[model samples]
Every structure is written in structure tokens, then in C-alpha cells.
Target: MTWKLGLYALAATVAAAPALAQDAKTLAIVVKGLDNPFFEQINLGCQKWLADNPGSEYECLYTGPASSADEAGEVQIVDDLISAGVAAIAISPSNAPAMANRIRQMAPSLPIMTIDADFLEADRDLRKTYLGTDNYLMGVKMAEEAAKLKPEGGSVCLQLGNVAADNINARAQGFRDTASGEKGIERLTGQKGWTEVEGCPVFTNDQADLANQQMSDVFTANPDLDAFILIGGWAQFAPQAYAQVTDQVMDKLKSKDLIIIAGDTLPPQTQAFRDGRSHAQVGQRPFEMGLRAPDVMLQLLKGETVEDPLYTGLDVCNQDDPGFCKDN
Candidate 1:
């Protein structure tokens, strides 16, 4: 079940956080935020597993900060969850470094793993395992899709979720490397004919409306921009705002004059692509992450080793493909 943490619980000490139904060992899926639909899919997967194994000894507890950008708040939630004596935790780590530091402080009291996002390589020993997308490769596929749409390589804008998120950073680096045809270039500005427009690569902090506004503002200011890459689906998460913003550039989208290769093919995002608002999408399987994480954590609790990074894989849909996310 989801966390019923009220404001008082959040504002008060860790003791204030409810430790409900201790009889059933808690297999918690603590995500970056409870708001993002991508994470919701993860929650649903956890719930689905619970429903399937009704007689199981463990319960899936999904909790997180209300706001995606609240890095400190996410850490606090993790602290509370650990104090509540949950059997295991699968953290998405909104801020990877902060979470890793916190994990270090606790020193692996209970089985801990990362889901969707992971800690840096130097600090990965803090978690038993990581279960999620190959973020860098996800970014590589994103760039590949954009390149397919706009082969000549022109001015581009990257929409990032969190500045400190290792996953997002990896995706950004992957995009830069692939798009520029230069491995490990810091920023994209006219390398191998691909350039990151001035004031581009706006960090959305995982705020949907603001991401849409930033996208609108960036595209409005730079109408000549050839490609827009959303490394996360922040803007598209708010479908109405995304629609309103992209409507202004419908002509360009229609003629393939501009390409928007976004990450995450949630229902709304997929629909947006079908509606011609976005050109392509590279999606991460959060549901699969959620579905498998509990088992992974349970195995860890049993002192069984799991894969270091268990990749759930990705799904790609492009403008040229008419059979994207459709049943035969």
C-alpha cells in the first residue's frame, strides 16, 4: 500500500512516520517523488506483485517526497523508512550523492537496493543492487532517434530532470557523445555539426508545468532549433501544457522541420507522439523495475547475491513507426 504520510508526519521527527502493519514484512519502494507517473508505474508494479502473491509474508510499501526536486525531503523520507524497521528498501535516489551519503551513515542495517536511479560508481557499494534502465544507453538511443529524424545534426535543446541525478547526468552525457559523434564532451556546442543552443539544457527539477514553460520559452526564443530532446517526460507529464506549447510549433512537427525525441512513453506521452506533438520516445520500464525489485531485495535479505545492475530494458517508438505501443 501507499504511504499515508500527512504533513505532520513529514514535518515532525522520524518517529512521526507511521509504522503500520509490522506483521507483514515491508518491501518498500521509495522513489524520488510520489507525483511522477513514471514512478507510479513502479508503484503499480509493486502493488501488482503484492496482489499476485496475496498470501506472501511481505507487503509492498511505496513512499516518497511530494515534490520530485526535494532532494533533502527524499533523504528524510528514506531516514524515516529505515527507522520504521522496514524489511528492505528499493530507493530511486532523487539525488544520488545525497542518498549514497545517507546510506553510508546507516551502513547497511537492512537490505538496501536502488531502483530506477543509482548511486555513483565510486559509492555503489552502499546498495546491494541497482534495478533500472541503462540511463546512458537510454540517452544514446534518444540521440540516435533524434539523429534519425534530423540526420544533418543542428541546434538542439535538452530537457533534464534533476541536475544532481546521476541517471539524468548519464543520459545527458550519452546524448552529447552520440549526437556530437565525440565521446565524453562536456557540453554540446558545434561539435561534429551538433550544437546545444544558448540557454538550452534547462534543468526542470522534475516540475511538470515549469518544464513545459521552459520548453515553451526555449522553443519560442529559438524557433530555429532543429531538435528538442526531453531526457525525461516532465513537460509531457503535463499533457495539456505540452499540447498547448507544441501547438505553436505544429507546422514544424508536421513537416519534420523539427524533431522532439523524448524519454518515457507513458500513455500520455505515447498519445502525444501519435497526436504529432512529439516525434519519438525512448521509454524506461519502471513497472518491471518495481515488479522485480522486491524479489531482488528479498534475495538480498536472505544473503543471496544479485546482479550488480539488473537492466529492465527500454522501448523505442519513432514517428516513422505506426505500430508503436499498439496491439496486433
Candidate 2:
């Protein structure tokens, strides 16, 4: 109508346009420890989802402890991304509860998705959904397989990457619960929670090496250890070291005698399982975590409901049966 009113309207529209553009901007993925294949799977998933959605893009930033035990490292990474002003953050948290308040403080409205390890506290406010394996079930799967390998389970040792991680903790719980449920199995005390966070041991770039050494030390210390269940990446190295040490101790003992059942089938782990150096493993579809996590985040951003608390299916890799144990 009036020239003054028209000018005001034009300025208002221009101001609103930038806000809208900012709303349509790409996402940010902040993960813990880029060094691990597990996080690599999440990266792959996020990138593939962004590629499929032509207009949307993503920026991925990773930080974590020198070892798998460092949960704090993951929280610091989330903080860094918030400072950088990200749209959304997809993380496989080392410590879900510990990182919750920090992320909430940083980006309260920013859509957060947890892959692999999860945080229930974050679900109430800061985060939208979690995508990963049913870690407790994964633990149960490991124990169930351990039973098959050693019907009379004597001593089971757990070698997990990060004890602070809820997922790893849940899996460990599941393993212990399942093992206890069984009539014959007796859980051992070789489970050492290692991480890259503060206070945890430092071997981030060299987790495989640490895993190898740890396994060597565990078996060497306890000759009575009947079964070994090492979850996550350390599972890969456990058998190699077990093979080496066990071979040195008793040449007649086959690798199967120890009843090794590990979790999260990476390339190395899958290869090891396939080669029969290890017994069986619980495989988390990590690639799918990377692929599906972004979609879940997008859904949350659009105010859509995600059916599963944990997305991305999981399965057991039983080397005894070649099909279940194959690599992705």
C-alpha cells in the first residue's frame, strides 16, 4: 500500500530469508575416536545418507580418548561441535550419561543421534533417538555362543574397549547375566575396561597393540581361564595374542579350547572368525549405523517418530556356521 509499509515488508522478508536458509543448512556429526572401525562405520552411514539426500550435507568431527576406556574424550568432541555451531550431532558415545548434560548445555535444540553406545538421559531432552545394536542382547549372544563352545564354562574373561560406554557396559552385563544363567559356565575376572578418555590407559592409535598385550597378559596370568569373551575391536586382537601365547604354553591345545566369543565384527574380526582363529562373535551392523543414523536424525528434525529405541539390526557371528559369521 504505502511506500513506507512496502519498504518495511521487503526488509522483513530479507531478514527472514537468512533464518530460513540457516534452517535448511547441512548437519554436523561429532563422534568419539575416528581411529576405530566402529566409528568409521558411523561415518560411512552418515556420509551415504547425505549423498542420497542431494540438498543436505554434513560436517563430521571426531575426538576421543587414547584408549577405548576414555568416555570423557567423546563428551569433549560433542562440546567442540556445539561451539562450532552444528545443525545436528550423531555420536556413538563412550559415556552416554556423562555426556548428556554437556550436550544439552551446548546444543539443546540440535538433533542428536546416538549410534552403537547410547544414553537414556539424553533421550529425555537433548537427543532424538539412538541407532545401534541391542548391546545387552549382543552380550547374551556372546555368552550363549560361549556355552556352545564350552558347555561347562569355567572362567570367562571380558576384554572390552570402553567400560564407561553404556553400550559396552550393557553388553558386558548381558554377557555376565547370560553366562550366569547357564548352569555350567563360571565367569572369570580378566575383564579390563580400557578407554582413550582421561584416567583410562593410553593406547588410542594402538588399541590393537594394547588388546594384543592385554590378552597375552590375561591368558599368561591365568592358565585356568577356560573361556574368553572380548567385545568390540579388542576382540580382533584377543585371538591373535591368545593364539600366540597359548601356542607357546601348550602346543597341543587348539585355539578353540579357550572358547573365545567376541562382539562387533569388523574386517579384522570377521577375517579372524572366518579363519577359525576365534570361535564366534556378536556382529553389530556398524555400516548400517552410519547409513541409518542420519535418516533418524532427519526424521527427528522433521518431528517424526522413530520406532526403535535402537536402530540398525544386530546378529551373532558363529564361525561354527560360516553364514552367520560373514563380514559386511
Candidate 3:
């Protein structure tokens, strides 16, 4: 071949090398569920990372179940990703224990990381690192926000979602501990600091309809209920919850007799807060979690150590200062 042609051929090969290498390696992002905008934000974060890192030699694959409670479905998706020979996996599990077990089963073969939620402390060795909010701190923030509204303290119901998940349990306990410590805020049930309302916390399984029903039942049973501390924004995300809230709690809200605080500032929740339906929301960095997970996974794959239980900070959004929630 001519000298000039040979040089051109070598340059072409060099330019194609990175693309070929990237096409071989795959990074799978498995989240809890795509139904919620939080997870959708996570997906977007992953995409943004991929776009920002132009030289990264890995193909990103994002997937999740339709519902948050589908542990088996999430497990199956991970299994599929593993079988597809993905170089690494980042997942936000529905059931932390089951996810830990699955990760252990595939250990030393694929690098697995957690996002948005984490495995139990005992199972920390299973995943490379956890990239998400500090649930306990998030709960504390929620309680602080509640105190701002009702400084004198009053009766409040706690709406929890999927008590089995690590994040859910942590936030519930954090809120309980903080609220209990507030002498002015009185818990009306015998379920200790954690489950103090309606005898026990209402678990919504991350379903909006179930959350609405539980909220309604609690409201009916305790007509004098002063506030609702939602550990998860389940009802706000569901369309059915709109009517239920309007019918059962709107009058009380308008009268300033009832206060509602929730976590996660998605479009629906932000709109509700703007409309004066909810008092405040605890904002989680789902997009940041998504953006960070892949970076951590890449580090793990390179045999570089990363911080375990990495936190993606929290923010409180209300009508006055909406923060990022205002974007919705």
C-alpha cells in the first residue's frame, strides 16, 4: 500500500478502536420501578453520564419492573443482564435482602452496585457501594420540616411504604426518633416511636391507590388527626389520590387544621404542594444517584475502591422555596 494510504488506514483503525471496545462492554442499570418519576430521573441521570463521558468504553442498559414490589421481576431482569455478559450492574432493589442474595450468588463474576436504596449493613460486602440519599437523615429533615409548621406539636399519622426495604425502614425509624425526641410533638399510639399512628404505620407497598385508602381510613378513624408524615410520596403520584385528598382532607387543609408532609418531590408532589395540598416534601437526589452509580461501577471495575453508602444529599421543598422541585 502507498505510504499515505497506510497512514490513513492506521488513523481510521485507531479512531474505530474505542467504539469497538465500547460495543463489547455493557453496564446495566436496574432500578426499583420505572412507574415513579424518581426512577425515571435516575434513568435520565444514567443517560446524562453516558453522554457526558464521551470516552467511556461501555454501553449503558437501563431497565426496571413496572411495579416496585416485584422482587422476582427485578431479580429476573438482573439475571438476564448477568447472562447477557454485562461488565457491571447498578441496581436499586425492591427487596434489599433478596438483592443481596442475588449479588452474592454472582459475586467475583460481575461488579454490582446499589442506587436510590441500599442493602442491609450486614450485607454491605455484597455490593461495591451504595449511591443514594441517607434515608435516616431524610427522615430527620422531614420531622424538622413538620416541626416548623406546628411548633407546638400535635397528633400525626405516619404513612410508610414497604417497611422491608432498607431505605424505607431507615427513614421511618429516623422520623420516629426525631419526632419522639420533640417533647411538643405527641405521638398518639402505643407502637413506640416508629409506628405511633393508628397503632401501626400504614404500609402502601408503593402503590398510590393503597396509600389513598390507608390515608382515608386513618383520617376516618381519627377525625382529629392533625398531620400526616409520609415517608414515601405514594399517594401524591397516583391520580386516584387527588380525589381522595380533595374529598377527605381538602376542607381540613383549607382551614389550616391538617398538615401533610411527604418525601420525594416529583411533578405530582410538587404540584400538590404548590396547590396547597401538601405542606412540604423531602427531596431526594434520584438523578444524582443515577449519575453517580455508573461512575462508581466504572471505578469498581477498574479495581479502584469507592466509598460505601455514598449519600446524595437531601433538600426540603415547600411552596415558598421550591428549589429543584419547582422545575416540575
Best by lDDT: 1
Q: How close is every model to the real structure, measured as TM-score?
A: 0.91, 0.76, 0.85
lDDT of 3 by residue, 81-134 (tens): 888788899888788888788777865457888888888899877788888889
Q: List clashing residue pairs in candidate 3.
A: none
Off by over 4 Å in 2: 1-24, 57-70, 120-125, 182-206, 235-255, 324-328
How many Å off is the CA of 295 in candidate 3?
Answer: 1.5
For residues 1-328, could you state the per-residue lDDT of candidate 2 as single tens digits? 1112222333444343222233454455555565565665555555445445554444333345454555677677668767876667777676666788787676777777777767764354666777778887887888788777766556656776654577776777677767666422334333222111122221223266677676667667766666666766553644566456445435323556565676766666667766556677677776666666666666777888877576566666675575555633
Global fold similarity of model 1 (TM-score): 0.91
Name model 1 segments beyond 4 Å from true.
Answer: 1-22
For model 2, give the 10-residue run with minimal summed lDDT.
Answer: 193-202
- 1 against 2, candidate with superior TM-score: 1
Residue 259's lDDT in candidate 3 = 83
Q: Between prediction 1 and prediction 2, which has the larger lDDT?
A: 1
Q: How high is the lDDT of residue 147 in model 1?
A: 81
